[model samples]
Target: MYGPIADTIRTQRLVLEPLEVHHAEEMAPVLDDPRLHRYIGGEPLTLDELRARYAHLAAGPAPFHQEYWLNWIVRRVRDGQAVGYVQATVTPAAPEFTVASASAGATVTPGPPRLVASVAWVIGMPYQGFGFATEAARALLDRLAAHGLRDVVATVHPDNRASATVASRIGLRPTGETRDGETVWRLPRRAAPT
Candidate 1:
Protein backbone atom coordinates (compact mmCIF):
# COMPACT_ATOMS: atom_id res chain seq x y z
CA MET A 1 0.00 0.00 0.00
CA TYR A 2 3.04 2.25 0.15
CA GLY A 3 5.70 2.36 -2.57
CA PRO A 4 7.52 -0.75 -3.86
CA ILE A 5 6.64 -2.95 -0.86
CA ALA A 6 8.69 -2.84 2.35
CA ASP A 7 12.40 -2.44 1.75
CA THR A 8 15.24 -3.94 3.74
CA ILE A 9 16.19 -1.74 6.72
CA ARG A 10 19.72 -1.66 8.02
CA THR A 11 20.84 -0.68 11.50
CA GLN A 12 24.10 -0.31 13.31
CA ARG A 13 24.38 -3.95 14.30
CA LEU A 14 21.68 -5.74 12.34
CA VAL A 15 19.72 -5.87 9.17
CA LEU A 16 15.97 -6.00 8.76
CA GLU A 17 15.73 -8.13 5.66
CA PRO A 18 12.48 -8.12 3.73
CA LEU A 19 10.66 -11.19 4.88
CA GLU A 20 10.33 -14.01 2.37
CA VAL A 21 8.98 -17.56 2.53
CA HIS A 22 12.46 -19.01 2.44
CA HIS A 23 13.44 -17.00 5.49
CA ALA A 24 10.90 -19.03 7.42
CA GLU A 25 13.18 -22.04 7.46
CA GLU A 26 15.86 -20.12 9.35
CA MET A 27 13.38 -18.14 11.42
CA ALA A 28 11.60 -21.24 12.64
CA PRO A 29 14.56 -22.23 14.76
CA VAL A 30 15.18 -18.71 15.99
CA LEU A 31 11.60 -18.55 17.19
CA ASP A 32 11.45 -22.10 18.45
CA ASP A 33 11.69 -21.45 22.17
CA PRO A 34 8.33 -21.87 23.89
CA ARG A 35 9.06 -18.92 26.15
CA LEU A 36 9.10 -16.65 23.11
CA HIS A 37 5.37 -17.28 22.83
CA ARG A 38 4.57 -16.66 26.46
CA TYR A 39 2.71 -13.46 25.75
CA ILE A 40 1.81 -13.93 22.09
CA GLY A 41 0.35 -17.33 22.98
CA GLY A 42 0.52 -20.66 21.15
CA GLU A 43 3.54 -22.90 20.77
CA PRO A 44 6.33 -22.24 18.33
CA LEU A 45 5.30 -22.68 14.74
CA THR A 46 6.71 -25.59 12.77
CA LEU A 47 8.68 -24.85 9.63
CA ASP A 48 5.71 -25.57 7.40
CA GLU A 49 3.37 -23.43 9.40
CA LEU A 50 5.84 -20.54 9.41
CA ARG A 51 6.41 -20.91 5.68
CA ALA A 52 2.69 -20.82 4.97
CA ARG A 53 2.25 -17.83 7.20
CA TYR A 54 5.14 -16.00 5.53
CA ALA A 55 3.71 -16.82 2.12
CA HIS A 56 0.43 -15.18 3.02
CA LEU A 57 2.16 -12.09 4.38
CA ALA A 58 4.49 -11.92 1.41
CA ALA A 59 1.45 -11.82 -0.85
CA GLY A 60 0.59 -8.47 0.69
CA PRO A 61 -2.46 -7.40 2.67
CA ALA A 62 -6.02 -8.10 1.56
CA PRO A 63 -7.27 -5.90 -1.25
CA PHE A 64 -10.54 -5.11 0.47
CA HIS A 65 -8.87 -3.38 3.43
CA GLN A 66 -6.16 -1.70 1.39
CA GLU A 67 -3.79 -2.46 4.23
CA TYR A 68 -0.09 -3.07 3.81
CA TRP A 69 1.31 -6.00 5.76
CA LEU A 70 5.02 -5.26 5.95
CA ASN A 71 7.36 -7.74 7.58
CA TRP A 72 11.10 -8.32 7.94
CA ILE A 73 13.44 -10.93 9.31
CA VAL A 74 16.00 -9.46 11.73
CA ARG A 75 19.47 -10.74 11.22
CA ARG A 76 22.57 -10.04 13.26
CA VAL A 77 25.25 -8.38 11.18
CA ARG A 78 28.10 -10.17 12.86
CA ASP A 79 26.82 -13.68 12.38
CA GLY A 80 24.41 -13.12 9.52
CA GLN A 81 21.76 -15.28 11.15
CA ALA A 82 18.06 -14.67 11.47
CA VAL A 83 17.23 -13.89 15.05
CA GLY A 84 13.88 -12.13 15.09
CA TYR A 85 11.35 -10.09 13.14
CA VAL A 86 9.63 -6.72 12.88
CA GLN A 87 6.38 -5.96 11.11
CA ALA A 88 4.02 -3.13 10.43
CA THR A 89 0.39 -3.17 9.40
CA VAL A 90 -0.04 0.03 7.43
CA THR A 91 -3.43 1.58 6.70
CA PRO A 92 -4.95 4.95 6.19
CA ALA A 93 -5.93 6.79 9.36
CA ALA A 94 -9.44 8.14 9.88
CA PRO A 95 -9.55 11.55 8.22
CA GLU A 96 -12.61 12.96 9.96
CA PHE A 97 -10.88 14.10 13.13
CA THR A 98 -8.07 16.32 11.95
CA VAL A 99 -7.60 18.04 15.29
CA ALA A 100 -7.21 16.70 18.79
CA SER A 101 -10.44 16.41 20.75
CA ALA A 102 -8.82 18.03 23.76
CA SER A 103 -7.86 21.07 21.74
CA ALA A 104 -11.34 21.37 20.24
CA GLY A 105 -13.03 20.89 23.64
CA ALA A 106 -15.38 18.41 22.00
CA THR A 107 -15.25 14.76 21.11
CA VAL A 108 -13.94 14.14 17.64
CA THR A 109 -15.53 11.62 15.31
CA PRO A 110 -14.23 9.31 12.63
CA GLY A 111 -14.01 10.51 9.04
CA PRO A 112 -12.60 9.09 5.83
CA PRO A 113 -9.50 6.98 6.24
CA ARG A 114 -6.27 8.92 6.25
CA LEU A 115 -2.29 6.96 6.94
CA VAL A 116 -1.41 4.96 10.01
CA ALA A 117 0.87 2.10 10.72
CA SER A 118 0.77 -0.49 13.47
CA VAL A 119 4.03 -2.19 14.29
CA ALA A 120 5.31 -5.19 16.24
CA TRP A 121 8.66 -6.80 17.01
CA VAL A 122 9.89 -10.12 18.37
CA ILE A 123 13.37 -11.46 18.98
CA GLY A 124 14.55 -14.99 19.70
CA MET A 125 14.92 -15.73 23.41
CA PRO A 126 18.66 -15.79 23.19
CA TYR A 127 18.64 -12.46 21.45
CA GLN A 128 16.76 -10.77 24.27
CA GLY A 129 18.63 -8.16 26.43
CA PHE A 130 20.92 -7.41 23.50
CA GLY A 131 18.88 -4.52 22.02
CA PHE A 132 18.40 -6.28 18.70
CA ALA A 133 14.64 -5.79 18.91
CA THR A 134 15.05 -2.09 19.60
CA GLU A 135 17.48 -1.51 16.76
CA ALA A 136 15.30 -3.34 14.28
CA ALA A 137 12.16 -1.60 15.49
CA ARG A 138 13.75 1.84 15.29
CA ALA A 139 14.81 1.08 11.74
CA LEU A 140 11.33 -0.13 10.84
CA LEU A 141 9.78 3.04 12.21
CA ASP A 142 12.21 5.13 10.21
CA ARG A 143 11.18 3.30 7.06
CA LEU A 144 7.52 3.88 7.82
CA ALA A 145 8.17 7.57 8.25
CA ALA A 146 10.02 7.67 4.93
CA HIS A 147 6.83 6.35 3.35
CA GLY A 148 4.99 9.43 4.74
CA LEU A 149 3.19 7.64 7.55
CA ARG A 150 2.34 10.10 10.32
CA ASP A 151 0.67 7.88 12.89
CA VAL A 152 2.15 4.69 14.27
CA VAL A 153 0.86 2.33 16.94
CA ALA A 154 1.77 -0.87 18.68
CA THR A 155 -0.18 -3.32 20.83
CA VAL A 156 1.51 -5.17 23.63
CA HIS A 157 0.18 -7.53 26.23
CA PRO A 158 0.05 -5.80 29.62
CA ASP A 159 2.22 -8.51 31.04
CA ASN A 160 4.80 -8.17 28.31
CA ARG A 161 6.99 -5.59 29.98
CA ALA A 162 9.85 -6.13 27.58
CA SER A 163 7.78 -5.19 24.57
CA ALA A 164 6.30 -2.20 26.36
CA THR A 165 9.80 -0.97 27.11
CA VAL A 166 10.80 -1.36 23.50
CA ALA A 167 7.70 0.52 22.40
CA SER A 168 8.50 3.33 24.80
CA ARG A 169 12.06 3.53 23.57
CA ILE A 170 10.75 4.04 20.07
CA GLY A 171 8.61 7.02 21.24
CA LEU A 172 5.21 5.34 21.62
CA ARG A 173 3.20 6.33 24.64
CA PRO A 174 0.57 4.18 26.33
CA THR A 175 -2.90 5.34 25.33
CA GLY A 176 -4.57 3.46 28.21
CA GLU A 177 -6.53 1.52 25.62
CA THR A 178 -6.66 -2.22 25.29
CA ARG A 179 -7.65 -4.35 22.36
CA ASP A 180 -8.14 -8.08 22.61
CA GLY A 181 -6.29 -7.92 25.93
CA GLU A 182 -3.28 -5.89 24.78
CA THR A 183 -2.40 -2.34 25.69
CA VAL A 184 -2.36 0.14 22.83
CA TRP A 185 0.66 2.39 22.43
CA ARG A 186 0.67 5.26 19.98
CA LEU A 187 3.28 7.59 18.56
CA PRO A 188 1.82 10.70 17.05
CA ARG A 189 3.98 12.07 14.29
CA ARG A 190 6.15 15.07 15.16
CA ALA A 191 7.32 17.68 12.75
CA ALA A 192 10.94 17.34 11.84
CA PRO A 193 13.19 19.96 13.38
CA THR A 194 14.43 22.58 10.97
Candidate 2:
Protein backbone atom coordinates (compact mmCIF):
# COMPACT_ATOMS: atom_id res chain seq x y z
CA MET A 1 0.00 0.00 0.00
CA TYR A 2 2.29 2.75 -1.24
CA GLY A 3 -0.43 5.31 -1.50
CA PRO A 4 0.62 8.93 -1.93
CA ILE A 5 -0.60 11.70 0.28
CA ALA A 6 -3.60 13.54 -1.13
CA ASP A 7 -2.14 16.83 -2.30
CA THR A 8 -2.94 19.59 -4.74
CA ILE A 9 -0.39 20.81 -7.27
CA ARG A 10 -0.80 24.11 -9.04
CA THR A 11 0.53 24.55 -12.51
CA GLN A 12 0.38 27.60 -14.73
CA ARG A 13 -3.02 26.75 -16.10
CA LEU A 14 -4.01 23.59 -14.32
CA VAL A 15 -4.42 22.20 -10.84
CA LEU A 16 -3.71 18.55 -10.20
CA GLU A 17 -5.39 16.89 -7.27
CA PRO A 18 -5.15 13.35 -6.05
CA LEU A 19 -7.61 11.35 -8.05
CA GLU A 20 -10.47 10.19 -5.87
CA VAL A 21 -13.48 7.96 -6.46
CA HIS A 22 -15.65 11.06 -6.81
CA HIS A 23 -13.71 12.19 -9.88
CA ALA A 24 -14.97 9.36 -12.09
CA GLU A 25 -17.95 11.41 -13.18
CA GLU A 26 -15.75 14.14 -14.64
CA MET A 27 -13.12 11.70 -15.86
CA ALA A 28 -15.41 9.42 -17.85
CA PRO A 29 -15.77 11.60 -20.93
CA VAL A 30 -12.13 12.57 -20.97
CA LEU A 31 -11.12 8.94 -20.81
CA ASP A 32 -13.64 8.14 -23.53
CA ASP A 33 -11.88 10.19 -26.18
CA PRO A 34 -10.58 7.88 -28.88
CA ARG A 35 -7.68 10.18 -29.77
CA LEU A 36 -6.28 9.91 -26.28
CA HIS A 37 -6.29 6.12 -26.56
CA ARG A 38 -4.71 6.00 -30.00
CA TYR A 39 -1.28 5.16 -28.65
CA ILE A 40 -2.43 3.81 -25.31
CA GLY A 41 -2.88 0.06 -24.95
CA GLY A 42 -6.44 0.04 -23.67
CA GLU A 43 -9.68 0.91 -25.39
CA PRO A 44 -11.69 4.07 -24.88
CA LEU A 45 -13.48 4.08 -21.54
CA THR A 46 -17.15 4.57 -20.99
CA LEU A 47 -18.61 5.95 -17.79
CA ASP A 48 -19.20 2.52 -16.34
CA GLU A 49 -15.79 1.35 -17.47
CA LEU A 50 -14.16 4.45 -16.00
CA ARG A 51 -15.93 3.87 -12.73
CA ALA A 52 -14.61 0.31 -12.64
CA ARG A 53 -11.16 1.55 -13.49
CA TYR A 54 -11.16 4.05 -10.64
CA ALA A 55 -12.52 1.47 -8.24
CA HIS A 56 -9.83 -1.00 -9.19
CA LEU A 57 -7.05 1.56 -8.85
CA ALA A 58 -8.37 2.88 -5.55
CA ALA A 59 -8.76 -0.55 -3.99
CA GLY A 60 -6.04 -1.25 -1.43
CA PRO A 61 -4.73 -4.56 -2.71
CA ALA A 62 -5.45 -7.97 -4.17
CA PRO A 63 -3.82 -11.40 -4.06
CA PHE A 64 -1.79 -11.45 -7.28
CA HIS A 65 -1.25 -7.74 -7.75
CA GLN A 66 -0.08 -5.12 -5.27
CA GLU A 67 -1.83 -1.78 -5.63
CA TYR A 68 0.93 0.77 -6.01
CA TRP A 69 -0.63 3.17 -8.47
CA LEU A 70 -1.01 6.81 -7.47
CA ASN A 71 -3.59 8.67 -9.57
CA TRP A 72 -4.35 12.37 -9.99
CA ILE A 73 -6.96 14.45 -11.72
CA VAL A 74 -5.92 17.43 -13.86
CA ARG A 75 -8.28 20.36 -13.83
CA ARG A 76 -8.34 23.84 -15.27
CA VAL A 77 -7.32 26.17 -12.47
CA ARG A 78 -9.78 28.87 -13.47
CA ASP A 79 -12.74 26.61 -14.08
CA GLY A 80 -11.94 24.06 -11.43
CA GLN A 81 -13.17 21.15 -13.53
CA ALA A 82 -11.53 17.87 -14.39
CA VAL A 83 -9.73 17.66 -17.72
CA GLY A 84 -7.67 14.47 -17.44
CA TYR A 85 -5.74 12.08 -15.23
CA VAL A 86 -2.13 11.24 -14.40
CA GLN A 87 -0.75 8.22 -12.64
CA ALA A 88 2.55 6.91 -11.34
CA THR A 89 3.76 3.73 -9.71
CA VAL A 90 6.92 2.17 -8.38
CA THR A 91 7.83 -1.17 -9.98
CA PRO A 92 10.32 -3.49 -8.37
CA ALA A 93 13.29 -4.01 -10.69
CA ALA A 94 13.71 -7.74 -10.08
CA PRO A 95 10.09 -8.57 -10.77
CA GLU A 96 10.13 -6.42 -13.85
CA PHE A 97 13.25 -8.16 -15.08
CA THR A 98 11.72 -11.53 -14.27
CA VAL A 99 8.58 -10.66 -16.20
CA ALA A 100 10.62 -9.40 -19.11
CA SER A 101 12.71 -12.56 -19.15
CA ALA A 102 9.67 -14.79 -18.86
CA SER A 103 7.93 -12.95 -21.66
CA ALA A 104 11.00 -13.34 -23.85
CA GLY A 105 11.18 -17.05 -23.00
CA ALA A 106 14.53 -16.62 -21.26
CA THR A 107 15.60 -17.85 -17.85
CA VAL A 108 15.07 -15.47 -14.97
CA THR A 109 18.16 -14.51 -12.97
CA PRO A 110 18.01 -13.88 -9.24
CA GLY A 111 18.86 -10.29 -8.39
CA PRO A 112 18.24 -7.69 -5.71
CA PRO A 113 15.07 -5.72 -6.26
CA ARG A 114 15.49 -2.09 -7.24
CA LEU A 115 12.64 0.39 -7.25
CA VAL A 116 11.91 2.35 -10.42
CA ALA A 117 9.33 5.03 -10.94
CA SER A 118 6.84 4.84 -13.85
CA VAL A 119 4.35 7.40 -15.04
CA ALA A 120 1.45 7.89 -17.49
CA TRP A 121 -0.82 10.79 -18.32
CA VAL A 122 -3.71 11.86 -20.54
CA ILE A 123 -5.55 15.14 -21.20
CA GLY A 124 -8.94 15.85 -22.74
CA MET A 125 -9.01 16.48 -26.48
CA PRO A 126 -10.11 20.04 -26.02
CA TYR A 127 -7.17 20.60 -23.71
CA GLN A 128 -4.61 19.00 -25.97
CA GLY A 129 -1.97 21.16 -27.71
CA PHE A 130 -2.07 23.58 -24.83
CA GLY A 131 0.88 22.27 -22.79
CA PHE A 132 -1.34 20.88 -20.07
CA ALA A 133 0.41 17.54 -20.27
CA THR A 134 3.81 19.12 -19.72
CA GLU A 135 2.57 21.14 -16.80
CA ALA A 136 1.02 18.16 -15.10
CA ALA A 137 4.00 15.97 -15.81
CA ARG A 138 6.52 18.48 -14.47
CA ALA A 139 4.42 18.88 -11.37
CA LEU A 140 4.33 15.12 -10.90
CA LEU A 141 8.05 14.81 -11.47
CA ASP A 142 8.80 17.53 -8.95
CA ARG A 143 6.63 15.79 -6.38
CA LEU A 144 8.37 12.47 -6.99
CA ALA A 145 11.81 14.05 -6.78
CA ALA A 146 10.84 15.79 -3.56
CA HIS A 147 10.14 12.33 -2.16
CA GLY A 148 13.73 11.26 -3.08
CA LEU A 149 12.73 9.15 -6.06
CA ARG A 150 15.21 8.66 -8.85
CA ASP A 151 15.10 6.83 -12.18
CA VAL A 152 11.67 7.87 -13.30
CA VAL A 153 10.61 6.18 -16.52
CA ALA A 154 7.92 6.58 -19.14
CA THR A 155 6.84 4.36 -22.03
CA VAL A 156 5.50 5.99 -25.15
CA HIS A 157 4.22 4.48 -28.34
CA PRO A 158 6.62 5.01 -31.23
CA ASP A 159 4.17 7.09 -33.22
CA ASN A 160 2.85 9.14 -30.33
CA ARG A 161 4.75 12.32 -30.98
CA ALA A 162 2.66 14.32 -28.57
CA SER A 163 3.57 12.12 -25.63
CA ALA A 164 7.16 11.89 -26.79
CA THR A 165 7.35 15.65 -26.87
CA VAL A 166 5.86 15.83 -23.42
CA ALA A 167 8.49 13.43 -22.12
CA SER A 168 11.25 15.44 -23.76
CA ARG A 169 9.91 18.71 -22.44
CA ILE A 170 9.99 17.30 -18.94
CA GLY A 171 13.66 16.22 -19.37
CA LEU A 172 13.26 12.48 -19.94
CA ARG A 173 15.82 11.21 -22.40
CA PRO A 174 15.29 8.23 -24.68
CA THR A 175 16.78 4.97 -23.39
CA GLY A 176 17.66 3.68 -26.91
CA GLU A 177 15.55 0.59 -26.32
CA THR A 178 12.01 -0.46 -26.89
CA ARG A 179 9.99 -2.71 -24.61
CA ASP A 180 6.73 -4.35 -25.60
CA GLY A 181 7.04 -2.33 -28.80
CA GLU A 182 6.97 0.97 -26.89
CA THR A 183 9.83 3.41 -26.75
CA VAL A 184 11.28 4.00 -23.29
CA TRP A 185 12.39 7.30 -21.81
CA ARG A 186 14.10 7.95 -18.50
CA LEU A 187 14.93 10.81 -16.11
CA PRO A 188 17.51 10.28 -13.43
CA ARG A 189 17.34 11.99 -10.05
CA ARG A 190 20.36 14.19 -10.59
CA ALA A 191 19.42 17.62 -11.83
CA ALA A 192 21.06 18.99 -14.95
CA PRO A 193 23.76 21.55 -14.08
CA THR A 194 22.13 24.93 -13.70
Candidate 3:
Protein backbone atom coordinates (compact mmCIF):
# COMPACT_ATOMS: atom_id res chain seq x y z
CA MET A 1 0.00 0.00 0.00
CA TYR A 2 1.27 3.46 -0.86
CA GLY A 3 1.44 5.82 2.10
CA PRO A 4 0.57 9.49 2.15
CA ILE A 5 3.00 12.13 0.93
CA ALA A 6 3.38 15.36 2.82
CA ASP A 7 0.99 17.96 1.52
CA THR A 8 -0.59 21.20 2.59
CA ILE A 9 -4.13 21.12 4.01
CA ARG A 10 -6.28 24.20 4.47
CA THR A 11 -9.22 24.91 6.70
CA GLN A 12 -11.28 28.03 7.36
CA ARG A 13 -8.83 29.52 9.85
CA LEU A 14 -5.64 27.50 9.55
CA VAL A 15 -3.19 26.03 7.09
CA LEU A 16 -1.51 22.71 7.68
CA GLU A 17 1.81 23.33 6.03
CA PRO A 18 4.08 20.43 5.23
CA LEU A 19 6.86 20.45 7.77
CA GLU A 20 10.30 21.59 6.72
CA VAL A 21 13.52 21.92 8.69
CA HIS A 22 13.41 25.71 8.59
CA HIS A 23 10.18 25.58 10.57
CA ALA A 24 12.18 24.50 13.61
CA GLU A 25 13.35 28.00 14.38
CA GLU A 26 9.83 29.33 14.38
CA MET A 27 8.48 26.33 16.29
CA ALA A 28 11.00 26.54 19.10
CA PRO A 29 9.27 29.38 20.89
CA VAL A 30 5.84 27.99 20.14
CA LEU A 31 6.75 24.76 21.88
CA ASP A 32 8.88 26.32 24.62
CA ASP A 33 6.57 26.05 27.58
CA PRO A 34 7.36 23.25 30.04
CA ARG A 35 3.69 22.93 30.89
CA LEU A 36 3.04 21.51 27.45
CA HIS A 37 5.12 18.50 28.44
CA ARG A 38 3.18 17.65 31.55
CA TYR A 39 1.46 14.68 29.91
CA ILE A 40 3.81 13.94 27.03
CA GLY A 41 6.84 14.00 29.33
CA GLY A 42 9.61 15.81 27.56
CA GLU A 43 11.26 19.18 28.01
CA PRO A 44 10.86 21.62 25.14
CA LEU A 45 13.44 21.31 22.43
CA THR A 46 15.96 24.02 21.70
CA LEU A 47 16.14 25.44 18.18
CA ASP A 48 19.17 23.35 17.37
CA GLU A 49 17.59 20.15 18.64
CA LEU A 50 14.34 20.87 16.85
CA ARG A 51 16.16 21.60 13.61
CA ALA A 52 18.00 18.30 13.76
CA ARG A 53 14.82 16.41 14.51
CA TYR A 54 12.91 18.15 11.77
CA ALA A 55 15.66 17.39 9.29
CA HIS A 56 15.29 13.68 9.91
CA LEU A 57 11.52 13.83 9.74
CA ALA A 58 11.64 15.88 6.56
CA ALA A 59 13.64 13.10 4.96
CA GLY A 60 10.64 10.77 5.23
CA PRO A 61 10.44 7.21 6.50
CA ALA A 62 13.45 4.95 6.32
CA PRO A 63 13.83 2.40 3.56
CA PHE A 64 12.33 -1.09 3.93
CA HIS A 65 9.57 0.15 6.20
CA GLN A 66 6.22 0.66 4.48
CA GLU A 67 5.43 3.71 6.54
CA TYR A 68 4.95 7.44 6.24
CA TRP A 69 5.95 10.16 8.64
CA LEU A 70 3.72 13.04 7.71
CA ASN A 71 3.98 16.18 9.80
CA TRP A 72 2.53 19.62 9.43
CA ILE A 73 2.85 22.99 11.08
CA VAL A 74 -0.46 24.53 12.01
CA ARG A 75 -0.48 28.18 11.01
CA ARG A 76 -3.16 30.82 11.17
CA VAL A 77 -4.19 31.60 7.59
CA ARG A 78 -4.66 35.30 8.31
CA ASP A 79 -1.43 35.97 10.20
CA GLY A 80 0.60 33.12 8.66
CA GLN A 81 2.32 32.32 11.94
CA ALA A 82 2.71 28.75 13.17
CA VAL A 83 1.12 28.01 16.53
CA GLY A 84 1.21 24.20 16.68
CA TYR A 85 1.70 20.93 14.79
CA VAL A 86 -0.20 17.78 13.85
CA GLN A 87 1.23 14.52 12.60
CA ALA A 88 0.22 11.10 11.37
CA THR A 89 2.41 8.04 11.52
CA VAL A 90 0.87 5.84 8.86
CA THR A 91 1.51 2.17 8.16
CA PRO A 92 -0.15 -0.37 5.97
CA ALA A 93 -2.52 -2.51 7.94
CA ALA A 94 -2.84 -6.28 7.95
CA PRO A 95 -5.25 -7.71 5.39
CA GLU A 96 -8.18 -7.76 7.79
CA PHE A 97 -9.03 -7.91 11.45
CA THR A 98 -12.06 -9.40 13.12
CA VAL A 99 -13.82 -7.06 15.49
CA ALA A 100 -16.54 -8.07 17.90
CA SER A 101 -19.61 -5.84 17.94
CA ALA A 102 -21.10 -5.37 21.37
CA SER A 103 -24.64 -4.75 20.14
CA ALA A 104 -24.38 -7.69 17.76
CA GLY A 105 -23.23 -11.11 18.89
CA ALA A 106 -21.38 -11.71 15.61
CA THR A 107 -17.87 -10.84 14.46
CA VAL A 108 -17.20 -8.07 12.01
CA THR A 109 -14.51 -8.06 9.36
CA PRO A 110 -12.92 -4.84 8.12
CA GLY A 111 -11.97 -4.15 4.55
CA PRO A 112 -8.54 -5.03 3.27
CA PRO A 113 -5.42 -2.89 2.75
CA ARG A 114 -6.70 -0.13 4.98
CA LEU A 115 -3.97 2.16 6.25
CA VAL A 116 -3.58 2.63 9.96
CA ALA A 117 -2.67 6.08 11.24
CA SER A 118 -1.39 6.93 14.66
CA VAL A 119 -1.97 10.64 15.00
CA ALA A 120 -0.92 13.32 17.41
CA TRP A 121 -1.25 17.08 17.90
CA VAL A 122 0.42 19.74 19.99
CA ILE A 123 -0.38 23.42 20.41
CA GLY A 124 1.67 25.94 22.32
CA MET A 125 0.49 26.92 25.75
CA PRO A 126 -0.51 30.38 24.62
CA TYR A 127 -2.40 28.89 21.72
CA GLN A 128 -4.54 26.64 23.89
CA GLY A 129 -8.30 27.29 24.16
CA PHE A 130 -8.29 28.72 20.64
CA GLY A 131 -9.37 25.42 19.03
CA PHE A 132 -6.32 25.39 16.78
CA ALA A 133 -5.46 21.82 17.77
CA THR A 134 -8.96 20.62 17.09
CA GLU A 135 -9.10 22.30 13.71
CA ALA A 136 -5.71 21.02 12.65
CA ALA A 137 -6.56 17.51 13.77
CA ARG A 138 -9.90 17.55 12.00
CA ALA A 139 -8.21 18.66 8.80
CA LEU A 140 -5.60 15.97 9.14
CA LEU A 141 -8.30 13.32 9.51
CA ASP A 142 -10.11 14.61 6.46
CA ARG A 143 -6.93 14.41 4.46
CA LEU A 144 -6.29 10.87 5.61
CA ALA A 145 -9.81 9.87 4.75
CA ALA A 146 -9.38 11.35 1.30
CA HIS A 147 -6.27 9.23 0.87
CA GLY A 148 -8.37 6.11 1.69
CA LEU A 149 -6.52 5.64 4.93
CA ARG A 150 -9.32 4.87 7.35
CA ASP A 151 -8.00 3.36 10.56
CA VAL A 152 -7.14 6.37 12.68
CA VAL A 153 -5.80 6.05 16.18
CA ALA A 154 -4.26 8.18 18.90
CA THR A 155 -2.54 7.37 22.16
CA VAL A 156 -3.05 9.85 24.95
CA HIS A 157 -2.04 9.89 28.58
CA PRO A 158 -5.11 9.08 30.63
CA ASP A 159 -4.70 12.20 32.67
CA ASN A 160 -4.51 14.48 29.64
CA ARG A 161 -8.12 15.50 29.44
CA ALA A 162 -7.32 18.17 26.89
CA SER A 163 -5.96 15.67 24.41
CA ALA A 164 -8.85 13.33 25.08
CA THR A 165 -11.22 16.14 24.22
CA VAL A 166 -9.40 16.85 21.00
CA ALA A 167 -9.53 13.18 20.04
CA SER A 168 -13.23 13.12 20.72
CA ARG A 169 -13.69 16.28 18.74
CA ILE A 170 -12.07 14.53 15.80
CA GLY A 171 -14.43 11.54 16.14
CA LEU A 172 -12.22 9.15 18.07
CA ARG A 173 -13.46 7.11 21.02
CA PRO A 174 -11.50 5.41 23.76
CA THR A 175 -10.73 1.79 22.81
CA GLY A 176 -9.96 0.61 26.33
CA GLU A 177 -6.51 -0.41 25.18
CA THR A 178 -3.40 0.87 26.95
CA ARG A 179 0.05 1.12 25.51
CA ASP A 180 3.01 2.61 27.32
CA GLY A 181 0.53 3.87 29.91
CA GLU A 182 -1.48 5.83 27.35
CA THR A 183 -5.08 5.19 26.41
CA VAL A 184 -5.74 4.16 22.83
CA TRP A 185 -8.44 5.98 20.93
CA ARG A 186 -9.74 5.08 17.50
CA LEU A 187 -12.04 6.56 14.86
CA PRO A 188 -14.02 4.19 12.71
CA ARG A 189 -13.99 4.74 8.99
CA ARG A 190 -16.93 6.35 7.29
CA ALA A 191 -18.97 4.39 4.81
CA ALA A 192 -18.24 4.86 1.14
CA PRO A 193 -20.60 7.09 -0.79
CA THR A 194 -22.82 5.40 -3.34
lDDT to native, each model: 0.87, 0.80, 0.90
The residue pairs found clashing in candidate 2 are none
The candidate maximizing lDDT is 3
Residue 140, candidate 3: how far off, in angstroms? 0.3
Count of steric clashes across candidates, in order: 3, 0, 0
Residue-by-residue lDDT tens digits, candidate 3, 1-194: 23344678899999998999999989999999999999989899989999999999989777988988899999999999899999999988888777877875878787666679999999999989989999999999899878777789999999999999999999999997999999999996677689
For residues 78-112, write the lDDT of model 1, one tens digit per residue. 98988899999887765656445575496656665
Model 3's lDDT to the true fold? Answer: 0.90
Judged by lDDT relative to the true structure, which candidate is superior, 2 or 3? 3
Q: Which stretches of candidate 1 lie over 4 Å from their true place?
A: 2-5, 97-113, 189-194
Against the hidden reference, what TM-scores do the models get?
Answer: 0.87, 0.81, 0.87
Task: Give candidates' CA RMSD values in order.
Answer: 4.4, 7.2, 5.1
